[model samples]
Target: MSNLPPLNNETIWDIINDKIDDAMVNQLVWDCLGYSYDNSSQQWDINNVASEWREEYPEPPNFIENRPPTVKLTRSIPPENKQLLKEELGFKGYKVGEFGPRQTRRATVANWLLSYMKQKRETSDR
Candidate 1:
């Protein structure tokens, strides 16, 4: 009875990433699967579409299984101290254990600082 297309992995992923809000994505998926969203369960009841899809396609491999763990930025450094640290890292040659040569270290640090500042400004505008 629904006008929605059949649900598939790619279709679900596209819906989720298509610049829509989470609620809309949930509704679309529910409608496509012919399942009403259940607030009590906080999920759509498994419909025949999902059951059939599961039979046809095994679950996706855990892509993030081997991914590096995310770094948590819980603590903030003072702006002046951060600037001083950047300057020190910029001027000093690479330490004995580091990967790159002295000149490369300065250039790399400078580039990183410039990129960091640019990203900060861009994100603040949002």
Candidate 2:
């Protein structure tokens, strides 16, 4: 016996119509599962989800004319690297002054620089 709730034809159609009606839900469903309404086929299909969505909505229309530009800084090192650096450098909570040894600080800086350089090199090679 399945534990799923009963969904009749009407209920299913209602849900589909609701999704089609709401742009936000439509976009979300498209992004999450790449599901979108098909006008030509006259039925919903996921033949080429990504391509179909892209073709339908080429790009998000400039709804906000003068919206603030988004700025994203990609960190070379992962969060775990930062956490490890803090732990290895002995950064204590409530400590006001320089904590770890100068050598440890130097080593951390060197390691970060090396990793950054390596990432750059790999990207450039590709």
Q: Which candidate comes out best when scored by TM-score? A: 2
lDDT of 2 by residue, 36-75 (tens): 4567876555654556344643443211121110000013
Off by over 4 Å in 1: 1-100
- The local distance difference test score of each candidate is 0.36, 0.35
- State TM-scores per candidate: 0.22, 0.24
Candidate 2: residue 3 lDDT (0-100) = 28
lDDT of candidate 1 at residue 94, scale 0 to 100 = 41
* Position 95, candidate 2: lDDT: 39
TM-score of 2: 0.24
Residue-by-residue lDDT tens digits, candidate 1, 1-126: 244434333333333233333334434433433455467877544454455433432322111121111000101223443443246333343457653332332233233333344455678999
Q: Give me the candidate number with maximum lDDT.
A: 1
| Every candidate's CA RMSD | 19.2, 22.2
